[model samples]
Target: MREKAQESVKAVLPVMVIVLILSFLIAPLSPDIMVEFMTGAVLVIIGMAFFSLGAEVSMTPMGERVGGNLVKTKKLWFIIGTGFVLGMMITISEPDLQVLARQVPSVPNMVLILSVALGVGLFLAIALIRILVGFALAPLLILFYLLIFLLAMLAPADFLAVAFDSGGVTTGPMTVPFIMALGVGISAIRNDRHAEDDSFGLVALCSIGPILAVLILSLVYQTEGSFSPEIGRNIATSVEVGQLFFEATPDYMKEIAVSLLPITVFFGLFQMFSLKLEKKTLSKILIGLVYTYIGLVLFLTGANVGFIPAGNALGTVLAALPYSWILIPLGMLIGYFIVKAEPAVYVLMKQVEELTDGAISGKAMQISLSIGVAVSVGLSMIRVLTGISVLWFLIPGYVIALGLTFLVPKIFTAIAFDSGGVASGPMTATFLLPLAQGACIAMGGDVVRDAFGVVAMVAMTPLITIQILGVLYVRRETQSADRSTGVEYQVDISELFAEYEDDEIIEF
Candidate 1:
């Protein structure tokens, strides 16, 4: 617990420092708002610590058990149906998707949610089949992404960013841990060279479902409403700051409860019917569920109530300046650090490291993700300023990302694709999205066309950067092996024996 807290602090503190610097020098926020922001930061840190620990103890185990048992049945239809049903249930409960659905005014909340959920369900079932049958992940990614881009051409122009953004947000904190663990559980049934590689790419494939689903839905529904940023309230006193978080706590408590309920219920049912584990293990999972609930409540409350307003305010202030172009560099800087603060990134990095047996270190993954997100944010800032179409960036970006799949190791490709989704969790939605929206508002740009794709941009760049890391790693390893192969092995035992006196040679 203590170690987790320290890790959480390290992850969050960098961004807090950046925000503080911005607040002091560039974007001067009111004292009251600053108080709110600081309070929220503390909550975020604490929440992340609990959440990380909780996921390890609870969500991961439950997912693994369920997945393993489901596959043990050896019934293809049963596995597919269970996978689809679980996918939809979990997607419907994901907080990030709900947040996104509210932001997207074109489609009704239920309609958008159901569409995204269905996409996830269908793709999840496909992912299960791929694992069981040992299909190559890259071909599926290439095919589906091609389909997505083709549909993008026919979908409404305004819906492009939102459609792509759906892919990122759907595989958020709530969804990543279980889905990743479930992959591991299912892949465990296979005893081939590709099992470990196959354990990944589930999140990657699941992410695509939302984009394709939303794009197809966009063809039917005309985008009607303009985008609106959630405005922050005026805070006058310290008491009000406390009051603000206190008030937001209940709503988040309710939201997190709703978010957690479906999975908990499913797990319970699975335990009774399939798992039937001993009480000791079940008790630990139940406790972990408690921690997950508490952590998510605090996390969402702090992010939505405190971080969103601060991000929006800072963005508005900076973009309103005469030299608003600085927003590009500033956005890049924030983007570099903000991704580290995402809860799911921690899970992904840890899982990748564990799965690879430290061949891919967490530090390396973090650096790659930071670089990816930094570039993505810089590109997004350009979009905000210029009102450019998202397709201009996405089409070429994905082409490069998909092309790299052929070059990098299969495991790296899977991790890279999964990292894309993991990178764009709640932090991106609450802070980065609001920041882009705020900047777009200041620049008189269309928020839907400009700001809505920040999450997608964040999601896309990691695919390239992580693969590049993989390329470098593989090159270094090959070079070392080549050098080792070139060297001749020789050892002289006579030199050591020469020093030994006859007095010590009593064995003769």
Candidate 2:
């Protein structure tokens, strides 16, 4: 746990330093706001550490146990039903989703929230069934994205960005650990060689569900109110900064409680009926849940109260500069570091490392994700300045990403897509999105069209960059094989599939 906290601090510190430097040099902030930002940074680091540890100890295990048990039942309907319910329950409780719902204009919070929840639930079931039946992930990905775009054409123009952003935000800190583990759990039941590869695309598919759901909902229920970005409250005194956080703390505590309740109740029922976990394990999970709750409260409070205001202020300042094009490079730099700070990215990297038996290193995954997010943020800033339709980016980005699916190892495709969702975690929602919103407002651009797609952009780039890494990975393996003197060894694309083909089935 101490080590994990240290890791979280290391991950977050670079971004904090970068922001401080920016504030000092380019965007001078008020002292009170600066202090609040610094305090929030501290809280975020600590909260992330605790949350990461807690998720590992509790959420991951619980999800895996439930998923594995359901698969073991050998009743298809029961497995699908459980998966759908679990996905909905966990998604509804995602704090990030709630944050997003609040920001979107004219849509009732519950209406948008439930639509996204249902999307996740339905796709999660499909993901489970896909793993069970050994369905090809790439084909389904292509098909669904086509469906998403078709729905987008029919939906309101302003809602396009929000629909795609919904997809990214739905798979956040709370949702990632459990949903990813559920894939692992369900895949554990299969004795087939491709089970490992199948464990990956659950997140990828679940993400798609929300985009499609929200786009369809947009067509049916048009938003009438125009988006109006909230202005951050000014802190009149230095002491007010502390008071600001202190007062907001209770509100977040309540929010976190509400967010965590559904999952806890569902887990409790699962424990009572299906898992019947040993007392020691249950005790550890309980403690971990407490840690998770506290960590989330602090994290959300810090991000929403501190980071959002600072980000908005920074964006406004930067956009007001004579040379505003610098926002692109600056946004890129922040994007690179910010993704490293995402708590869920750590979870995804760790899981990938374990699943692949060190074939794909966590460090490599981190670098790929950083590069991807960096490009995304840069493009997003361009969009904010120009007010271009998101379709301009989405169309080509998905094409390149999907094209690479055939060229790279199958696992890379899955990991790449999964990384898309993970990269756009809480930090992007709380900080980067606000930054874009501020910039959009300053530049006199449409907030809904220009600012709303930051999350989508963040989500899209990983699909391409990770697969590019996959190409290099294949190259390295091929060269290594060719260098052997005694025997002529050939590297086949099928060899990449060999890792998952091992018949060793994991047992709960």
lDDT for each of the candidates? 0.90, 0.87
* Model 1 per-residue lDDT tens digits across residues 192-227: 999999999999999999999888988888875477
- What CA root-mean-square deviation does each model show from the true structure? 4.2, 8.2
Clash number by candidate, in order:
0, 1
User: Local error of candidate 1 at 31, Å?
Assistant: 2.1
| Candidate 2 residue pairs that clash | 193-501
Find the 10 residues in a row with the least total lDDT in model 1. Answer: 487-496
Error of 2 at 304 (Å): 0.8
